[model samples]
Target: MNLKILTLDEFSRIDFINLVNKVFEDYTVPIKWDVVSFQLDVKENSISLSDSFVFLKDNIPFGFIVVSIRKEKARIDAMGVIKEERGTGAASYILEHTVNYLKWRGIRKIQLEVVKDDIRAYKFYEKHGFREKRLLYSMILKKTINQEINYRYFPVEPRTAYIQALEIYFNGRKPNWQREPISLLLSDNRYNFTKIVTNSGEGYLVWGKLEKENVPIIDIVAKNNYTDILKASINFLKSQTNCKNILISSVPEDDYLYQPLKKVSFQSILTQSEMEKEIF
Candidate 1:
């Protein structure tokens, strides 16, 4: 089969969005076409249009790869091949082209995340020399409206400088790319940050609005003896907003807050593997 690859700019934004949404129609998370969201992702991850690509057969798009270049590192922000085009060597060809393209651009490392349950993708990356680095999780907490919050806390605006400083003493492993400090800083300013002080130390939580008035906790940090700080922060969030549930994503399994998150009624809803490859 004669295959052609096009730069992301080859198609208009709407056309490109349609192609991606079609290719990922069955993805674990539904992908929607929103210019604002797409632009935010590009800005947050420093994605360059030159590094993004689309694969075509007969001049029709069948696969695509979204890449973000950061100095010596490159990340596969997203990649997909249409369902009908799978098993035809299209994915392999696209991967090869993308890797070579990155290498030519002086990218020494490439990283991506695969849903743990996506056996095919997991094996595909492993077969292509990607090493599974760590487990990242999306956890959720649900509660009744009648429940009461006993702990007192207050909300504050999320500041990049403050988060950068707190990261120095943060005991948890770094989260996946999207939840990292840089991503948070690039995110819209609507997110709410909260702090809790206890005899032991100080803990912080960053949360944002979600559908149905739900609040998704973006990141949390607490000291060893201040695990209860997670509880207080949640209570503070509940008291401030009419959020019905709380969702947290990309939490490392080994993080100090992981166990405490579970104790606060958070349960794992999804899991992904952060994978990386070194290409000199």
Candidate 2:
């Protein structure tokens, strides 16, 4: 059984996509990515093909790891091996190699998220020196908000929203990788931005305009009056779209939006543990 590990760029885009779908076919949340979605993930997540790795067994793609780099920090955006290769030590080899490479490239830290209930995954990372940093939640709001919004909200440019988000993040707000400022900047054109100013404080909302029943609330930051800001934002989104539900993904439990999301009737559907390992 000959095994080889190569950078993701060594494979064609289609081959990489196929390997990803195959490796994650039975994941807790199975992901099927077409070319468009795959490309978008690469772009928005800062996935570096040259830094990522794909594992091959006898010339066949058997597993893969997607890495996203930002200066001295990196994230394991996704990683999985096929069921057949699970216990063959291939995962350990891939992770060790990837960590060494990141250290060699001067990366100081690496982070990833796993489903909170996935014991095997949690133990695997824990054994490999990764520790839980925080809890993240995927929330959804299905029921329509029937209350009136007293505060006024106005549409703004993506740049404006990003500036506010960055300030909030720098000022003690902890955002997950997906909701980081860079992620927002990379996918700016895909979302609509709005800001609300009231006597209490100010806030901004970033949401996607999709032609589906589920609309994504990408980022929401407020200096004060969080509950009211969230309510007004939801009311505004409801008025602007015909969506059936509002979805918010990977919100850190310690973030300012967490309690407000709960206060506004958003229910946590899935929870993930954000794990980190220092490579230095």
Candidate 3:
């Protein structure tokens, strides 16, 4: 079978909304398109959190996958072959070629997660040399705006006090990725610097939109009442007239806010188990 691989930019040009919507149209006798995982269908700018490749056959898209590759390692973010095309070798061929492509790029170890319950995904990744890395837990809040969450969002620059608040809650020197973005937001008046307040002090969502969707990329930082701060921030986003979704990245598994998120209407769509392999 002849296969074509497109970069994230190329995939965005195609009408993928319908393709993905069809995949999740049926759950158990209901059309639940919104139930699709946030990572699977995202805008071009949204997917820039990392590099991704999409696969096609005969000038048509049967299925596609996304991966994040660094110099030393790579991760399979999400992958699927359309039901009709399954067992037709599309998945195997893509997986084999993609790994080689990465290997040639100097990425030694590749990783991904199979929903602990999805036997087929488990076998698929295993057959392709992905090991059981870690059991990842995912949570979401569907109905978070029901209650008036008691937290304040300040439209202010991420000052020292604000960064200090984050240090206390998240308990670390802020990662460079986050700080740089916050710094950028601070100097730019156009970017909305939304901060949340709690008894534990304050947290920040250094975000704003550069595109059609209101989903400003979240560079979340909190100190003290981590859970409360995040809940407040999320609720605020839900109330926004501008953005439809909030995309939080690189949140840790043991985050204090994880449990609270479960209590809300959030769903566990999928998890990316952390895995590793050495090339040399």
Candidate 4:
């Protein structure tokens, strides 16, 4: 089958276009164009392309995987194969090769975040000897105009106080953490972080829209509740004269945000477990 792995830059115009289109159609993900562009940006400068892999048949791309190097670990980000080529052992082969490649590169561990409800993908990871690490408690709090908090931005503003609270939120909330935002901050395409200041406090919303998917995901957000600053922001989004889907993703285990979403009747979506394998 002449199995091979390809990096973003190494991919020809045709192959890149093919993989992205497949991802959208098969995975039901939106905005393949944006992903493709962002892939090039990070793949070219930050991530080492040679570190990624592509499966091929003769010179045709049958399957591909995008691996990322973060800190001392490597993660599998985007992976997909041509529909016709699936079940031809392409997926297993690519994963096996990736493990070996990372081991040879002197790495000991690899991890990736998979979406909840993707049973097949999760099973594949299990078969490959990966173990679930953590689950996030994701929640969505809908915005209601009935409750709005007034706010100002600094000094006397509760919004300023909210940001101040966040400064300490991480310290007390994540005592053992070295940094926050984890791989989500490097670029706009990676995450949509916006600063919202209310009269009583301020916070940030890590949410954005995907090009292919009409839904705008509200990932992880931190806001102050002093005078209902959180509600105001939610109201703002709910009031948005824009077309968007207010969804949360990758909920981790024991998330404080879970309670609020449940109270507001926001449905609880399944959770994804971050899985890892020791390659070294």
Top-lDDT candidate index: 2
The better-scoring model by TM-score among 1 and 2 is 2
Candidate 1 wrongly placed segments (more than 4 Å): 144-157, 160-166, 169-173, 222-226
- Model 1: how far residue 219 lies from native, Å: 1.1
Task: Give the Cα RMSD of candidate 3.
Answer: 7.2
Model 4, 1-280: lDDT tens per residue? Answer: 4655566567775656567576558573332655567565453224556787666688877777767775567777667778887787878888888888888888778877666578888898899999888765444433333444654322133233235445655655431111134333344344445556766556555545544322344433454442354455455555543423356655545454555555545565556667889865
For model 1, what is the alpha-carbon lDDT of residue 122? 95
Q: Provide TM-scores for the models.
A: 0.87, 0.94, 0.58, 0.73
For every candidate, C-alpha RMSD to the true structure in Å: 2.8, 1.7, 7.2, 5.3
Candidate 4: Cα lDDT at 41? 46
Residue 14, candidate 1: alpha-carbon lDDT: 75
Model 2, 198: alpha-carbon shift in Å?
Answer: 4.6
Off by over 4 Å in 3: 1-12, 15-61, 140-151, 156-193, 206-220, 231-252, 259-280
Please estimate how well model 3 matches the true structure, expressed as its whole-model Cα lDDT.
0.55
Give the worst 10-residue stretch by lDDT in candidate 1: 144-153
Number of backbone-clashing residue pairs for each candidate, in the order shown: 0, 0, 7, 27
Writing each residue's lDDT as its tens digit, candidate 1 over 107-172 gives 999999889999988999999999999898888888724333345456665664247435744644
> Of the pair 1 and 3, which is ahead by lDDT?
1
